[model samples]
Target: MTDLNQTALQKGADRALEKIEIDTLVVGAGQAGVAMSEHLTKLGVPHLVLERNRIAEAWRTGRWDSLVANGPAWHDRFPGLEFEGLDPDAFASKEQVAAYFEAYAKQFNAPIRTGVEVKKVVRNAEGPGFTIETSEGVIQANRVVAATGPFQRPVIPPIAPKDDSITQIHSAQYFNPQQLPEGAVLVVGAGSSGVQIADELQRAGKNVYLSVGAHDRPPRAYRNRDFCWWLGVLGLWDAEAAQPGKEHVTIAVSGARGGHTVDFRGLAHQGVTLVGLTKAFNDGVVTFQADLAENIARGDENYLSLLDAADAYIARNGLDLPEEPEARATYPNPDCVTNPILELDLAKAGITSIIWATGYSVDYSWLKVNAFDERGKPKHQRGVSGEPGVYFLGLPWLSRRGSTFIWGVWHDAKHIADHIATQRKYLAYRDASQRSAKD
Candidate 1:
């Protein structure tokens, strides 16, 4: 039965590929792309969503099986489809999240063409629309929405030394400790991914060394509510202070302890060896910076700043919020602040594996237009690109702090759809006027 259904779907996709023109071409079928497609469908626009793989491919394959959403199920729902059959506060696993997106696409009957990898998106030289060359066929679209998401490619630093003797894997490729060879693991980058992977490895009874870097350390819950709830109340998610082209701080969330705070201090106390930023790797010797203590202090300072902002917001609004519980310093134990290990021999430490949780970079090489800036980042105003018919979605701070998250992309999607509709209407009126003048 499933095979028959797939066959019918493939035939329909083939027919769609034969089409020479479409109203809009959405170049992704993740949460962002499906949301955009749903809005476009409501606007009665003829559109197609192209996915390189299956729907929600990132959640299906990019993440580990045990990985769950950082936010709760309630907060991760798309428009019109709240998470049911699960506890609202429970963290949805990777499989569950993927299934949610799949269900969303099916529910809306989103026009998504799976396995259709877009090769290039270039402006049509002979017309006002764009010519999208995909693996299936060429598609001419009046407007193109790039919802390829924030994490395009895993970034490994150029200075990272490579040796065939050690097994190195990026966080994207890392599944679990069991997949790695027998030895201690050195996890680099102190962001969410780094901390989570380090914690997992440590819990697996493997000796884990976590490299501490600049990061934000917000408590998972604050004042009897989740930190995200307070952030929403304080309007921090929509803060105007977050400037464009700035690297955003990572929020550490750990489901291991029922969504408790995951920070360097906490990890240090959990028998995980905390180290400074990895500086270099030569031969079997790995050198680290002497700035772990400073980084931890910086993180604490940032946390304090967040609390101060929340307090000021409460005062200004005259809202009687619950006072914070007695303050317990995060790093009370002097041993938590370890003496920086400037250098270590990987072989001597029995560290056979290195997991680089260094983060991701956006790849827009397939987009052939002047829409990108010098930094190769799309130059756009709240999802609307400088190019008339070009738009972007799922970009960090595209519309707000929540723009990149599943919960916040609906607004940007709706805005983009509406903008496209308005522009097309104006174009139609202009064309009619020109024809009448000619007559």
Candidate 2:
């Protein structure tokens, strides 16, 4: 830790030992936590933000060195902060994203304490508050906001065969192709990260095999504009009805020059060997489902559906917009979708590295409250927890489809801040009333 981090940790330890009472405690000082703290500060709600590492630690270290935001800098801006020095159309690099969050915290003076790892959060039996046990010490807060983002711990499958000869790493741990040993690489999961990593490896002169799964391949640019622009114009982000039970999908694009679309056909044209989803790995052999063509068809259908929806929105609104000349030509070629490789011998294929791009899941084990479901997902509606005084932020589709993004956090944060302020006022009023009755 740097001197700054050390000082912050010392201050947090001192505060913990004192058992300082804060109106609200926001956990995880990433974009979500910072946004929440900013709103609370504006509301004049006494609150503290606790972070396990430095501000925006995930964006600082979780992503690859070459990783950049899939969305444009213009659309990724948080409330009261926009990309000023950089081109709005350009994608932000990971370093730039982290720096932006750090700047946002400083701009608003968010009360964030770094290096304070929250070990447990349980209800205070003695009072109407909660006890938060941290590495520094303990804190008592009337309310808590779990601002931890959706991506918590990487979800690697337990079915992966144990092999001593082959090296395995999750996509979160992968930096670039140079880090892998010299040999063919098998990347599991055809989501945004899997395809991007496979493409990078193939471009680096390594033989790459990509495992295909159910994924939506939205066009990076549509009708001479970014796809996100159309989504926003069509109000997809602010859709009143939430898609409640759908699995979270990754955005299929890169922050390259002019934004690069991550499509199956593009990867295939780049000489990436496509395979179906991994079934099992046993005794140096890997088994895959034989559904590559079907999966490609499904993705194509989704692409067409998105285009149709955009067309309908344009016609319905009587808006005249020029269509892209290359749109029709850019559609995936069915011939490019390869046959699925049902099985492959790892030794024979010379495949030494297996990258699991499987997604993530939250771990709320430390939360000793009945605010979570059977699967450990928080039981909340638009940041409000079933258990009073506890809340969640930065969840996908929490209020809208964009809830997990930087631009959408402000909506949820403001609502949560207002809710907390109301609770505080009620508590104060009730206490005064009780005292008056006694008098």
Looking at model 1, report the run of 10 residues with the lowest lDDT sum. 1-10
Q: Model 2 off-target regions past 4 Å? A: 1-17, 240-245, 249-251, 318-320, 330-338
lDDT of 2 by residue, 1-439 (tens): 0012223433554354345667688999998999998888887777788998999999989987788888899898785887758898888888999999999988866778888889999998886879889888877888889999889989889977798788899999999889999999999988778877888899899999898877777777776667788779878888855544345545556656458666687788778888887999889999988888887777777677777777787789887787754554553553435545799999999999999999888877778988988777789889899999999999888888888878898788999899998987887799899999999
Q: Please provide, for model 1 over 1-439, each residue's C-alpha lDDT reduced to its tens digit, 9 standing for 90 to 100.
A: 0011222433477564644567788999998998998898788777878999999999988976678888877777786886658888888888888888888888767878888899998998886788888888787888889999889899999867768888998999999788999999999988778888898899999999988877777777666667778778877777644744335666666654468776676677788888888999887899988888898887888777777777777788888778884433565534635566889999999999999998899988899988988888899999999987899999888888888888789888999999988887897799899999999
lDDT of each: 0.81, 0.81
- Model 2 has an lDDT value of 0.81
**Deviation in angstroms for 388 in model 1?**
2.1
Candidate 2, residue 31: Cα displacement in angstroms equals 0.9
Kindly report which residue pairs in candidate 1 clash with one another.
Answer: none
